[model samples]
Target chain A: MEHHQSKSFPISHVIGFVVSLVLTFGAAGIALKTNLSFKVIMWIIGSLAVIQAGMQLFMFMHLREGEDGKTNLVNMIYAVFMVIVIVVGSIWVLTSGHAAH
Target chain B: MGIKWDEFFITGDPLILGSQIAILLTMIGAVAAITYLKKWKYLWTEWLTTVDHKKIGIMYIISAVLMFFRGGMDGLLMKAQTARPEMEFLNSQHYNEIFTTHGVIMILFMAMPFLIGLMNVVIPLQIGARDVAFPQLNALSFWLFFSGAMLFNISFVIGGSPDAGWTSYFPLAGKEFSPGIGNNFYAVALQIAGIGTLMTGINFIVTILKMRTKGMTLMKMPMFTWTTFVTSILIVAAFPIFTVALALMTFDRLYGTHFFTVSGGGMDMLWANLFWLWGHPEVYIVALPAFGIFSEVIATFSRKSLFGYKSMVFSILGIALLSMVVWVHHFYTMGSGPAVNSFFSITTMAIAIPTGVKMFNWLFTMRKGRIKITSAMLWALAFVPCFVIGGVTGVMLAMGAADYQYHNTLFLVAHFHYVLIPGVVFAVFAGLYYWWPKMFGFMLNEKIGKWHFWLFVIGFNVTFMPMFFLGLNGAVRRAYTYSAESGFAPLFMLSAIGSIILAAGFAVFCYNIYWSIRYADRNISSDPWDARTLEWSTASPVQFYNFAKLPEVKSLDPFWHMKKKNEGLTLFDSEIEEIHMPSNSWLPIYMGVIFGIAGFLLVFEWHIAAAVAAIGIFAGLIIRSFDYNEGFHVKKDEIHRIENAWRKTEGEVHDHVS
Candidate 1:
């Protein structure tokens, strides 16, 4: 089992780090230098953040690399869904037309 | 020092003063007894610093039982105070503190540890693993939790208790309104304990995923193990939310941050939302394991395999997922509107489906099998009907519109107690009864256990059932008293009497332990219940190295299969070699003390002292990181010596029985 991969340099990790950096700085550049509307910039940054997170998980963390990898992947996806439900749901409810404020 | 000596010591309340004295005397007595026995070195080496999961689990169980006693006392105090109209047993302020402590201690200290203790004791053994993946980390988790519980417990006598609700909603918990160190204890203590729980979560997840015996697939694991796996995932995901919430609340209280304040652009509602966000899943974290326990117990006692094993596992996963999305149901009255409420209502009601699936699975598991009416099975049996009442009421409350009527009323109180008491508490009792013979070597007295069970169940229903009617009659909760003319006095008195019965039931359980230890039958075999699962393959009062040679798992109930086929009973058939085991260390207890000192100082706003203690803790961590001791191994001779001694005891028992 150990002989299948001597695991020299982690080229995938290097690529992931570089890609993450590019996406992060790209979003920052758009926020600072571009004349795009706030909404458009927000969308771009959100997409970059999601993509960067995915890279970190799959490439860096090796979340899908073992017998239990599928369970791990499914749990991560469900966790993401829960985060969205909590964060977005809270914001929506608290900022809605019928909020206590 | 920011502390005022006069206010800090909590004087002028006779009830509290009496309790303070009692607590002091008890501590002194305990210390004196331990010293008189001259067991300090033995205790320190064998128990305190031990990293064995079984011993750690026993310690957790002992501590949880003690906390349950403390919390139950707080509850009886509430009952006495509210037994009748115009009761003067407890003033409003004292009532507030008692209720707060009661809620916090019962949920966090008692219920959580009880379940975690059982999991620690059973999960590794159930999976045919020697121990959890990280045994030292497991010990640290227990110590951290113990220290946290201690820190919280000391608040009542030292500086008063948190008078805000256990939920500790801000503006109420803020420094302006609270102006004391009570809520500070809540934030810091739970923060410490929650971190420990999160570590246990990660530890178990890794253990189950990476260290199962050969041929045991995930789907082939027992129902209890499956629930443990899912519950651990829930803990890992949910506890971080609580960690962040507690940190922000601590900042708001200690450092004058506006995170949950009504002013400074802060939204107090965020606290509530974040709280329930973690809080809802936390309910499942406790209940799901209880569900797993019932599944295992029901199948074993019924003399059948667990029904719908695949669906049982999937329903657990389903419940775990649904648990995260239903937080909003807790606050439908917060004016989140029909859209938000409807969404939450649907999700909340949807939980019943998975729960119903579980309920049906248990029923079918026992449908046509030989049902043994043992004390453990009785608790599981009672749980079905009681939990159904709780669950149906839960679905009723899930209606956002209907909850508006039930909100903040005793109806709501009755509803949750229905759910939690039967759902979590009864299951704890069931697991305790079922696993007691495994943890200890003797069975608990059956007649006494039946008495305890019946009184507890009847008293529980008698106490909480009237609250539903009271809620419908517009009686509110958290009130210190009601007028005689309110027509709630009779029911309140009845509930108070029922609580006394419940207390009697708990007393009987304590007596049962004492009685059993002294006089019960002791020649019982390891598998006293003739049950399934790999845990029973080991000796009762399980060996430290669990299995002398690791057993091969071929199915969910490997022990049952082995027993039926007369295979794998003598696990030491393989050549006995040196077995590697983790060494015990004092580092965990030292870290616990360091964290405790830091927390106590911070509670009093002693920044310099706290910083020094915090630095000491970090230094301990750094020292641990550099340490390279990989632990010791038990030689083959030592293994043979222990095995022979065990065999001698077994042979004696066999001769006595024959």
Candidate 2:
């Protein structure tokens, strides 16, 4: 499977590497430097992390390069769905108990 | 929580002391027997180091059975103590520990492994793969799980057993209340095992998705394989929450963090929420496969195609998605209020739709068909009503307001036991009976199996049926004893008697294992049950390289279809290819031991030792990266020899090949 490794200039790896680093620092800066409310700050950082992870999957991890790439994408999407359920549900259950309902 | 050297090795309980001695003797005896028989190298090479999924699966089954008996013993003790009012058998603390350990071991250590063992043994073959996606990782998963289980089991003899309920909700599990190192076992041991389970999830997803034979599309996969795929997805999604929860718990207990502690702005309810978030889907992780097992068993025995096979697939998928939302039903009375409660309650009740669909599918499967009543089929058949009782009661408890009455009551206890016993335990037995000959070389004795089944199923009902009443009669759970005036005695006594019968049934099961090994007919067909999946296409006591030439898959129940068409596994003129098999590695076991030591040290707050052991664990990973163990290949001549031997004994399968 790894036989396709080439001696070509790997621009994708470099781009993914720089983007991941920037996202990491960018999220940290938002959490530490911003005067935003806790909930807002958390949302910003979580979104950044998800974006960074998606980039890593496509660019660095080659998640979309294989024959099973579509399946991998679906698995990740399901994982993201579960994460949203857990995070959103926990917040709803904990703080206001979702009085809007 | 401070560690006390003198408090180590619990001395007061006579039962514990006896067990401590028994454990020592058993360990010594095993070592001595291995040494005397001069089989240490053989053991190390063949059993411990081998990456064969079948062998690893057998090892899992053995550990799960031992733990099952241990958990069963704890259950029996709890029953004996509660059998009558004011019983003096177990003090409150001892009773607390017994019940807690019983819940943890039965759910985590027992049921999970039993199903996983079957999955490991059967999934690859059913999916038509040589091994899992990663064979060495599979080995690692098993050892880590086994080691973690051992670490948890040792807690009773060592510092103390975790006295909190198996749920291990915080404040109770927090260091202030649980001042000993007991719940540390809950945190660390389960974390270790949870990682193993997570890896197993990933391994299976890749295997089922990527490793299926030609012509077997996703829809064409057998029901069991499909269930396994769904279960793996649930495991991956759910267990991370447990791992995170346990990590936080470890931090709170050991480093004195306040993630779950009462003070320092900690939220205790978060632990409960997180636990059930993982815990609810965790049940389906075990249950869906049982559904798959029953699908295979029922269809095979009834001589029919599974009724609503597509619906079975989609319902399990629906159940998995719904499971995530309904965890809050576990704590509806925690005052999440009407909106949250109703939402969760509705989702909880909604689960019954799919579950009911499955329940009827099984019945419709047997409807107007040639139903053969094997011992395995009997278990599958019996599961319907028992699970229905469990599921219906579960729906009752799902009503948020109604749960206020049921919470912490034996009614809740009765409800789950009804569900899990039939849903998980009965399936284990059915799968065991159905697949025994394929694993070993002979069938389990049916007459003795009948005794085991009748006694166990009856005992199961007799023990738990009264609990629903006792619970409704205002009996709280985890109460060591009650006064005669409370009038909970007669029913408790009846339950106790039922437990005794259960124990006897289990004893008969153990005896059946021995009897079958010694005297059951060995000259059985490879397809002992005339079964439908690809697993039966190979020889009984299947070869190290499972299929000599990989079997072609034309449709669902490929082997059965092959039989109908008067076909063999592969073309007789087809050239047998040399097979690639993973090499044996001691690294997995070594990693387990290292992690076990680290976890043990961390449990007692011996930081330096744990850190050193942690380094050893890391060293294993480092070594693995550099190690180029590309594995070995089975030559064509060897494959031919093995194939000929199977055909010689069971010429029926290959008779039509030429």
Q: What is the CAPRI rating of model 1's predicted complex?
A: acceptable
Clashes of 2: 0
Model 1 has an lDDT value of 0.88
Evaluate model 2: give its TM-score.
Answer: 0.95
* Local accuracy of candidate 2 as per-residue lDDT tens digits, B1-658: 3557898888988899999999999999999999999999999998999899999999999999999999999999999999889999999999999999999999989999999999999999998888899999999999999989999999999988988989999899999999988899899999999999999999999999889988889999989899999999899889999999999999999898898886866889899999999999998998999999999999999988899989998999999999989999998867887889989989999999999999989999999988989999999999999999999999999999999999999999999999899999999999999999989979999999999999999999999999999999999999999999999999999999999888888899899999999999888878877778899888898888888867788878888888888665653635788788889999999999998999999888888878988999999999997677678878877888888887776544545321
TM-score of chain A of each: 0.75, 0.68
> After superposition, which runs of candidate 1 have C-alpha atoms over 4 Å from their true positions?
A1-72, B572-574, B648-658
> Candidate 2, which segments miss by more than 4 Å at Cα?
A1-73, A97-101, B1-3, B570-574, B654-658
Q: Pick the candidate with the highest DockQ.
A: 2
Error of 1 at B100 (Å): 1.1
Return the clash pairs for model 1, or none. Answer: none
Q: DockQ for each of the predicted structures, in order?
A: 0.37, 0.39
- Note the clash tally of each candidate: 0, 0
